[model samples]
Target: MLVAYAWLTLVGFVVQLVPNAGPGALPRTLAWTVLGLGLVQCLLCTGVLHRAIDSYLGTRTVTDARLALPAVLMASMTALTVVLVAIRAVEVGLEVGLGLHGALAPFAVTFGVAVPRRTAALALSGYLAATTAALAAAGLPGADLLAALVVVGLGGLLSVFTGRSSAWYIAVIRELEEARGVQARLAVAEERLRFSRDLHDVMGRNLSAIALKSELAAQLVRRGSETEASVGQMTEVQRIAREAQSEVRAVVRGYRDVDLPTELAGARGILRAAGVDCRTDNGGSQLPAPVQAALGWVVREGATNVLRHADATWCTVWVGTDPAGRSALLVMENDGTRGQAPGGSAGSGLAGLRERLDGVGGTLRVARDGESGTFRLTAEVPLAAGNDATADEAVTDPAGTAGTHGSGTDGKDSAE
Candidate 1:
């Protein structure tokens, strides 16, 4: 709209230069000056307007002076165009009246772009007052001056509406950005709370047990009871402490197996809260507990990737035995893969998952369908002897023993 007004104003200036317009030397010179000012005003107005938008959107700051400059120029140009027309009006007794009103149109359009509601209104009011005074000074008839004021007055109102509307639109965008930031912070806080809860669950009961046994041992020593009871209590305390230490390690490493059904439900809730559509099929409940644990890790990792890496609008999770019923399968699919390589060389999280799956004779596969802009993750663990044999073989096989003992090959292979 601003561009159109600028072009129209330029065209009006060109029209004033024509022979039929009866522009005298002074009028012609003033027209050219106004045209040059309008060009500069347009450029400066564009920059100022952009800053105004950024300020409103909370992305930048702007001072009143920055906004005032373009608005002042717009008013000046409008007043100059009115002065030129008033000069022609005086010469030809209102017959050549308002030939330059088109030039004023661009300034009117730009008034809204360059300033906010109150500022635009004040600027336009000042221009109208100046125009009225110039017309009166040029001996324009009272009726002619009134008509000119009416026309410019309407343009001023239009500019105020335009500026106010732009402000409202920018305000909405600002609010949305703020809301997104708040949501992200809340997600982080929730994650911290979840970690704390897990730590408490892993250590709370064991710590209580250790405390009770310690008290019992103390009581026995004080009463001069059998040393065997005290020895057993101390031994039990040691065992409990070791178990708690292991559980703490598992929690810290995120290796504790989450129940499949519980993780699926949580995933769906989380995705929905983030404004993503989530669907799940919980058909693999009949699978062995170890298989479920491995697949549950897959779901957890997949959901995390979707939240962290993709701009997904929808996610689907499927868990069931493979068609042959020989393997348990977990599949997660989400749209908006962001063109990232699917399952690109394992990050720490996926690497850990890979190790857990490999321990149970499972494989993790990631597929990216660029044409569909979707990412899919598949985790499959054999449901039969393959799962148990993998663990047993690691325990009994001489080659496995050698790999574990020689050059840390088993550790390196698992890391890969």
Candidate 2:
């Protein structure tokens, strides 16, 4: 926008170059000088804008935000250049109406993108006053001077409104990324809590009984009674210990294993909360354990990538048998890309997914539609030879149009 506006003003000046040009006419050299200064100022304005926004978003403690040193420095340099250009216009006897607006273009972007709001109003006020004084000294009539001020002032304010609105949305995205990080950590912590509870339940009563038996054995020995009861007590303690060790191992195994249905539900809920409308279909209740585990990991990784990389508004997860029923299939797809080509994201965790699926005699394929920006990940783990018992129900609608939904964070979810 700033570039286009600057070019428009340049076109206006070029129009004045026709034969019999009025008081606004300039020598070729001064016109060239003006053009050089404009390109330089525009570059500086662009740099200042980016730096200022980075500084604003980088702030952790302040709501009003502070400008970075580079942004401030570039803005100062651009201001100096603007002054030189204004003086040159006046020296060349350019009319106030013709050249003044061009001289003020940089100020609009500088105020909108670089200046922090805390100082924007005061700075703009000072600038308007200084501009009025400069135009008066150049011998401009009062009416033309006020008109310039009005036009310049309105442009700067509009810039402030539009620029700040964009900045606000950027800030919200930063907040969403932070929130997603917290959600992942909370999921991990919740899993840990569940494991600890399982361990406690398996150990709590058995440990108490072992303690009581040991105490009884020690009391019997102190009282000089027969050793048989103590020996039997120790034997019983050994049995209980063995039982506990087995139960503890089972609990650990369960903790490490992923349940396919729970994972499908989790992926849907997570993507929904992150503002992507997600649909998931867990086609069968009885997939072989290893196939389910491998596909569960696929869902997990695919959801994470979408949250981290995509500009997606929708996602789908489908798990069931293929049409031939010789292979169990899982597919995860989304309609977003961050400039990545189909299969272009292999280095970003796709390789790991491939290795895991390979262990289960499965293959992973990624297909991308560049024109539509759709990314599809398909993982097929072959069913044991001659096994065709799994159903193709879950995949009947590849788009999951009749599937259960994982809703937006604000809305209630429902199965379709």
Candidate 3:
């Protein structure tokens, strides 16, 4: 825009000079000289505006000015442009000269100059005084002088208003975008806190019981009394260790796969001790990692649910390949649990299982029969969906060791 305006100023000079070039009119040599000077002033005005603006907006790196230097620099240009216009009016008619001033007025306006307030006020007052003295010295009459001051003053003020408004709005928008980024980071931190709370929920109670029982067992050993009581406390510790192991497995199996055979055997052992009589079958096949993982989580979550249920008498788990051998199907069903849990919302654990199955390009279906007091969770994953997982990375599930959860053989009246 600055360059275009400069070209426009040159074109205006040419147009006005063409018809007015003659005796008692604009001289050719003087007209050409003013024409080049006018164009240069227009470009310089544009550049000067950026000096103040770029510093204010941080769009460019600039050293801080002493404020006096900038005030003097800008105020001098204001006085110079007015004096030059008054001088040119002596050759061209005052009306044509002032018309040119109208075109050049934009150059004198400085916005966001970032100078001290007193310096700015003094600079503005100085420019007005210098302009008046220079114009009178150039022989401008009283009425012409007033007209020139009004035109230049109003044009400069108007440009300042426009440029400052734009800079203010740009600064506001930048701050809002920065605030939005901060809000997003805060939300991620909040989610991490919620995840930690879930880990606490999974492990907190079992850990407390372990601490109390271990202390009791140590006391009994020191007294050398009731040896069977110490043995029982240690046995209780073993049971809790198994439950804690399975709980951790259910909490973090989404990252990788678990062994289906190991997981099934583990679940069977846990349920039998609770008198739930759980049975599991994997169809004697080595399924893909993702498929096995999906099914493995089903067994773990199902067994945990059964052991936690008040009247879970039986549960059956099955994992098998379809007739086409292209997809693997998993189904787990248990009697009693959801009827006491209204709306079957206690089935939230199943919702997480569904999400896990979805990651392996699979689907999960759940049904609860309130009348029969039965809950069933079914899942299926495509064998080809996993894309031949990179050589089975070790998973830290309870199956981390072949029968970590099944290590305890003792039965308790109530499931931990």
Query: lDDT of model 3 at residue 276?
Result: 73
Pairs that clash in candidate 1: none
Q: What TM-score would you give candidate 3 relative to the actual structure?
A: 0.46
The TM-score values for the models, in the order shown, are 0.56, 0.66, 0.46
> Model 2: which ten-residue window has the lowest total lDDT?
407-416
- Tens-place lDDT per residue, model 3, 11-54, is 65334643454443334444455554555555555666666566
Query: Across residues 1-416, which tens digit of lDDT does each residue of candidate 1 receive?
Result: 44554455456543553333334677666666666766676676556656655665557766767656655765566566556665662243232233334445555554554445676677667767777787678666778767667755764565456655666766875676578678779988998999899999989999999999999999999999889999999989877776675566557646454688998998898788777899999998887777887788888888888777788999999998877789888999999576666555556888888888887778888788877788888899999744575575456343334333433335433443
Q: Which stretches of candidate 2 lie over 4 Å from their true place?
A: 1-31, 58-102, 112-115, 129-150, 214-227, 257-262, 272-282, 285-294, 309-314, 335-338, 341-363, 367-374, 382-416
Judged by TM-score relative to the true structure, which candidate is superior, 1 or 3?
1
Query: Candidate 2's residue-wise lDDT over 184-269, tens digit each?
Result: 79989999999999999999999999999989888878888879998898878776765665566557657767777888898898
Cα RMSD for candidates in order: 8.4, 11.2, 20.0
lDDT for model 2: 0.64
Model 2, position 353: C-alpha lDDT score: 88
* Model 3 lDDT, residue 339, Cα: 51
lDDT at 390, model 1: 54
